[model samples]
Target: MMVQCVICDILEELDNTAPEAKRLRNRPIHTYMCAACHERVTARTNERIATGKFRFYRSSRRIEGDFYS
Candidate 1:
């Protein structure tokens, strides 16, 4: 399947049998990213993480209760 990288806007090809290709075919909302862009972002994220400040906060609720029922 032919897909374009949202970051670099480059056109690329993927095997039709690949899971990623299947996902894109099944879900239009899913976007594609080229390997170069993915690697660049990963390196930058690692750099920030190494600086001791980057954090990923999710939606899980904190349990304030200390006693069990």
Candidate 2:
């Protein structure tokens, strides 16, 4: 299954077995806004990711583009 970002509707697959995945899965279904919207809502999301709240995986395309460009 996928979790859609509250602000942008970008879909991300959920991995329940992985360690990082487990942390997120165990938490409540909290709302996560897109980058821009997150800035307005609060600084929590950015802070969480920075502090290792959850492991993040970017889209393969984005990774490829970043390295190839």
Candidate 3:
């Protein structure tokens, strides 16, 4: 299957039976990022994390028992 990287907009080919190809075929919301762009992003993110000011926030899941009397 052929897919385009969302970041660089470069086209690349993937084997039709690959798990990633299957994901792109099955989900329209999922995005494709080429290896080069993925590595660039990872490196930049690691730099930010190393600065000690980067905060990674995640939603806290509430338990049902917490709300019960």
Question: Which of 2 and 3 is the better model by lDDT?
Answer: 3
lDDT of 3: 0.84
* RMSD, every candidate, angstroms: 7.2, 12.5, 7.5
Residues forming the 10-long window of minimal summed lDDT in candidate 2: 47-56
How should the candidates be ordered by TM-score, best one leading?
Answer: 3, 1, 2
Question: Of the pair 1 and 2, which is ahead by lDDT?
Answer: 1
TM-score of each model, in listed order = 0.79, 0.32, 0.82
RMSD of 1: 7.2
What's the ranking of the predictions by lDDT, best on top?
3, 1, 2
The number of the candidate with the highest TM-score is: 3
Off by over 4 Å in 1: 59-69
Which residue pairs overlap in candidate 3's backbone?
none
Give the alpha carbon lDDT tens digit for every residue of 1-69 in model 1.
899999999999999999999999999999999999999999898798679686556433333122111
Q: List the residue pairs that clash in candidate 2.
A: none
Worst 10 residues of 1 by lDDT: 60-69
Where does candidate 2 stray beyond 4 Å? 29-69
> What digit string (tens of lDDT, one per residue) describes model 2 on residues 1-69?
356677778877766575645555677565544556667555665466568554446668677457435
Query: How big is the positional error of residue 66 in model 1, measured in Å on the Cα after superposition?
Result: 25
Q: Which ten contiguous residues of candidate 3 have the minimum total lDDT?
A: 60-69
Model 2 TM-score is 0.32
